[model samples]
Target: MAEEPRDYEALMALYQAEKRRREAAEQNALEEKRGREAAEQKLRPTNLPEFLDACHIHLHASLIVQKNPTMSTQGNPDNAKNKLRPERLERWEDFAKHQMAIWDDIMASDFASKRQFAPLSALEQSGKDLRQQKIGSEIDLHIFQRDTVDKRVSSIIESMYYNKELREKFNLLGTVNFENHANMLSPESQLEEGMEQLTVHQKGKQAKEKQPSGSTDTAGSSHPRADQFCHRTAAFIVEYKAPHKLQLTHINNGLDEIELEDIVQDVVQRKVDDKDDVRRLVAAVITQAFSYMVNLGVEHGCVCTGEAYIFLRVGEDPRTVYYYLSVPEGDVTDTTGWTAGLEGPNRLHLTAVGQMPARPSTPSCGQAEKRHQSSDEESGPDPDTPSRQQSLSQPLSRTQKTTRGSSSGRGHHGERYHQIDRPTFLALMRRQLADDLDTDCDPVGRPGAIGVLFRVRLRSHGYVVAAKGTPAWFIQRLRWEASIYERLRPIQGIYVPVHLGNIDLETRYHYEGICELVHMMFLSFGGNLIGQHLTAENKTLVSEQVKRSADAIHGLRVLHKDLMPRNILWNEETKHVMVIDFERAEVEPISAKRTWKTPTGNSVKQGQTGPSACTKEIRRAMTELNALTIVIRL
Candidate 1:
């Protein structure tokens, strides 16, 4: 009745097929368009090297046209009679080839090996001669002299390196010289035509005035004028009269001569300015210098003058301090010495401190024999002296301990030991062990024994063991640290030392060394501590570390109570992170039992005293140990 139901199913299928076909065709067209665009991009000559070459050629041609305006007009001699001679054309082609060769060499050289003034080397060799020859032919071309050549060359090089967009604006070199002068034929023309055309386009009419004449023999010594630009916080101008002869001046409100004199006389002389005051000044200067370098995007060792001088301008006063760097006088093949010099006055110098060995003086045999006889006479111990020495050397017997009371306060808590000598303690250890200690165990293998501590290697990767056998009570306190390390060893990124053993007789509780501690810390909590080493991209690392620390605590049942700077170690080589001193860590199960003492002497206990005392004490000890650990992330 209704046209035999119109074949509804077949018609629907046909419509679906048509829609699919159209979609497929459209997708294929998009794919083809993308491929074509990519290919075109490749052919468009976007390579930096090619672009720079083209820019150099264009600049070179423009410079030639401007310097020799007669050639541009003579080439079309029928209407305008100025033309380039056959010999001049050949010379220009030769110069262009030389420049291209030099440019290629510079581009091919490694960035690390390339000097700052590398691009100007070729210009220095031939630029002045070329300008002089051009000016000699045309007496009227005095305006485009030696400085003009330098300005043109410098402009092109700077644009190529610093201003890529400007260089890329003119893709192909053209000869339609845009002479914007009010009167094109005027004898006193304000605009100079030719290679100066590019300069005019970039900087307008003032370009001619700014162009540097390549004739300056000492262009390197031309320091930027004080009025040019400087940061308000920290800035300095270093002028060098000769190689290794320099004058440094810092421009800042703080560190003025008058203020420094006042500080030295009123504060330091009067003994009123404590270490804190000196530290504050040092810190301020360091911070300002760091900020200044970072803002300028300069490498640490690149900006220093040849003589390595740094001046600090005193804030709020018109005075400056000239800090003379005492670098070793020799051929400074290494850049580290230059870098250290830039770090300012606090750099350590062993020679300056009188720690370096003094020259040996020869003694006569007669003088030596006389000294030996005197020593022999003095070595004979008197009866009273021997009894006194014996008494001093005698160890406290059990009877003496009984008389002093069995509960002697020698090893009691809060007991402080004074007048302990490092050498004596080391000698005692040697006597107890009856073996020679490894020379490598010493810090830096130097003469000084003060602040000496043992470094022990661990079996696990990224773990070190440290120990000191000082006071018995202090050594006992270290046992708590051993317990903390044992608990935290299993946690990822936690660099707590494994409690290998505590030799009570030797009073040495072994700890993992700092090297391994740092390695593991980076692996576990690297994102947080990575900023300590990476200055440029620190914000990202800092944010990541904070985020990770929070997430780890929330998700992995971990707690890093000692989240200070020193507790975190970042491995520079592997970029791994290690979190040390887990004496304060508390897993989720025992988190409640973590007790922290308040400033008001009130004890904050975490759980039931009887049931959780053991776990609570352990956590509490860890928390206390964390507080004791020094934080030095930087």
Candidate 2:
């Protein structure tokens, strides 16, 4: 019964070939790792900190600020007085402190203090040239109005952007737009009192204008309207006023001398002297900045007079505007460790301005976050009775939906999100997922470190698309989840949400205290929680649907590892159950059946099990689902 010598030699040869193949595979994997690391290194921007420092330095050097000589107020004097007043003015106590903390962190980091890149010398020289051009008497003649101030600031901002290294470092997805084209801020919105006049003028012009012969109404046209509202991706809002109109002295005297509460009342009652007049002027501009901030839903903005920059932030309340004045000429000193010795006015500090642009890159960082709704209240809204607003209000948090406080108890559940049709969603994905989409509302489900689930609407077609994303660190896990969805494509839009393609976001989402996720996976809204519509009448129906969904997944050899009632959704209209959250789910591996020799020298095949592991997991989930149903019924 001994094997032949030639057979043994053949087996040895096969073993050697297998070993060689393993070595080659290992070598290829090593090469791939090296390639990835090299690519990452190349993509990583160099001398960004140096460039930011250079921008601040050059901006201060080339700065030309002239005061307006005219001493007059526009519109009604009463209106001017009213414009300066807020419903309530509360001092943002921690505005400067928090900005300084970020600055300190930047300074303490290794990259901030590193040696300058080679191109930075050329960049600084260009800045010096700009400073030289502004040295003449022509600078004296130039009135530092909104346009002038914008040009001066934009010179530096543009310079920072043009540099390939700095753009990469900041991850500059959105532009620093001087022009405010937001539909909410448009004249028709009437965000400001005087805007009604502008709206009337526009309407009158529209009436006078004739349409082309045989042309239908733009709104009624089958084609997309040319005048459709387009959201300009603004990194942050910058409100500029002439330096002479709103001076550094005005801000210092108005804000420092008077309490915010008193300032509001003083402006309203038309109380007091020259100093109060200056305060009223400062307040008017601050009020303007607040309006723009609320309309845009951006938490941070700056009111930049040619001379000084008033870094502003809004907290949980839309009306409450926080201000921190930064005077580049005085506050920033050209010393070896000036940042270390700075007392206040951290806004224009090199580190602070440097860090500011990166805020939009990480949209959630350093902003207040709304509380996640508990599982009991995660059912969302009933489709039959959709009590929702026509337009979105500015949320307190960067990514949270608006909350209305009413005794009707609807405020506690948060705003209901509008849904997009499947055809529109597919068209958007086909075009470009990242470029076409913009964050519409707050996050949908509970956000974990691995990923954050939120709703993003299409830019041209305004309809919400559910996006699941994670930071680069957790991208693999997100990819894994996406792969699982791909495997379950057969049941998509039936027992699960439709799987839209995945994409890398054009811009990075920076959530303060949370991950800055760049990778996004798009999916259809998977309906609401199972318990939301689970009742005595539909309990059997719900249970059958849930069981059917579980079976469908199991049939695909996919095990729903973390299957629970929270992960299951029941669509009331469709009366179908959809399962979600497959982060921990696994596709069962396929293997050949094993044959073993018995002690009696008889060949026998391995016995089959009562049920497969995938089936077992489904059964276990069903048991938990049944228990949850019982609890809900009670």
Candidate 3:
């Protein structure tokens, strides 16, 4: 009886242990399922601002600011800010009201919000503790200082640019540290003597590739210099003054109260020597930002002190600048008051979202319109010209002329070259190339692509370039593509983009710790992808165009191995087709045998010589084009 009792107790204990294990496993599976569901829910489409709000990136940014509060420190030894002189400076009383009106207009319009960046946000938030902990530590443990400020600002800006949705919506690229890095294309004096383009294709010669030039500005430059330069041509630059150097009191003081002459003459006469003068310090920093904006020919700029953001915009007269100071800690709030949306003194300003008051319009196709009118005037109006008006009107919807002009020269031609001064064009090219590259439109390549294509517009003259950027390690592919472009030189503007040149951009684009872009090859913008616009009506036309483009490539004794729909482009206005991405192309020798498959599934080989051989060579190249053409047939 005693032995039986002991056996029963042992069995019961084993059963209880197994039941507990099963229960724990069930709970874990349920939690994981819920987690997956939450992630999926977050991935639903949203706008940039809304998505940012949900992800709490801006909140975390605020936390970073709170944790690393600004500390007082000694001013810079250079006293450089005092020397800044702008042609004119003014703080319009109606600036904030004007900005609010623009916001209202934007909100009332049929504005399309960009898609969500949930995955990206999750990745960005990973490895960092989200829970409100670990904020306070010993000074020896947590080293929050000036560097932390740079990292935070840089991180936020970089993260914004990385989001393809945000980039497309805002038409922004990445930022460049002009203080530390050189412009990719510098003046002759800025570069080493006899520094020529690297023979990148030559094996083992990669080691000799020219490193980028050090920091150098224009000669006789008299403008205030900023640390960070954003967007090519410095259209939108940002100046970061450490909070220790620039405080809230300085920013809070209205520039309207101080006389422009008092500030400018003081700086010029070297009378504003007191580093402790709060009003003088504020004036100096604003003047500094204004000078950079004027010299860069940009209208928009920002002066950040980590705790404060001062948004500046130059007026129609480049000399006159307007400033709006925003302190997020004091300005922004969770609650929305009854008069929140109203345009009044008590109206709320959501400055954290980086919304600016309306400005002048953007670039349009006026040149194209001019050409059409000239042809009409020269050749007389055709009956079909009226019919073609609607088609022409599509690309010319934006009527406002671009404010972007070069101080160095007349101006630049856009994607399509017009007869212009070659010397002027060359000068503009050297001036426009920056350390970082970003597209104003959608990127053709995915995040992890070896070669990403960006449609970059020149800031000076709005000349668009199809910039193909890749990491330095992938320089060989770029070299190969460049050679292929050279071989297709005869069809430069007709069937392909004009090869501008190549440069090694020292700035690195980071994403998921994968790779960084270090080199950029500039070419003219080929039109949109043909595959995207395939309609029942234009299918046959598209097919024929692709075939013609392929024939042109084949005539050069080159085989474009990849001739899919994605590789083909159609310019609707020009009625011209273009083929790109010659990375997989192969050049054949004169004696090499050329073969292609016919529509009847028969193998055909080209002759060794004569016009018949040329005809047969095209047939071989058309093998791939057959598949592209068949897309329309189906």
What total of clashing residue pairs does each candidate reach? 45, 9, 0
Order the candidates by TM-score, highest first.
3, 2, 1
TM-score of each: 0.23, 0.36, 0.38
Quote the positional error of residue 609 for candidate 2 in Å: 87
How good is model 2 by TM-score?
0.36
Report the C-alpha lDDT of model 2 over 347-414, residue by residue, as the tens digit.
Answer: 34433244344332233222112222322323322111111111223221211111111111232333
Winner by lDDT: 2
Kindly report which residue pairs in candidate 2 clash with one another: 67-244, 68-244, 362-510, 363-510, 364-510, 364-511, 364-512, 365-511, 365-512
Across 343-408, the per-residue lDDT of candidate 1 in tens digits comes to: 332111211111000001100011001111111112211111101111122231212112112112
- The CA lDDT at 191 in model 3 is 39
Candidate 3: clashing residue pairs, number: 0
lDDT of 1 at 192: 38
Model 3 C-alpha lDDT per residue in residues 1-634, reported as the tens digit of each score: 8799889989999999999999999999999999987776556654434433433333324333233533222335124333435555566667666666655544443332445333444434441433333222111112221222333333333444455654454454453222211222122212331232232112111111233354222222222344455322334556666554565665675444456667657667877554425666676677766665655556777776645777777778765667777765566544223131244332223434433223222111111111122111111111111111221222321111211122112355444434234355444554454433443422332221236555455555445445676666557767777778778877765676556566666455431112346676766545555544555567666667766877788788667654544456665545678777775566655554655432223444644443444455345434434443344445
Candidate 3: what lDDT?
Answer: 0.47
Error of 1 at 131 (Å): 65
> Candidates' lDDT values, in order?
0.28, 0.49, 0.47
Q: How displaced is residue 447 in candidate 3, in Å? A: 25
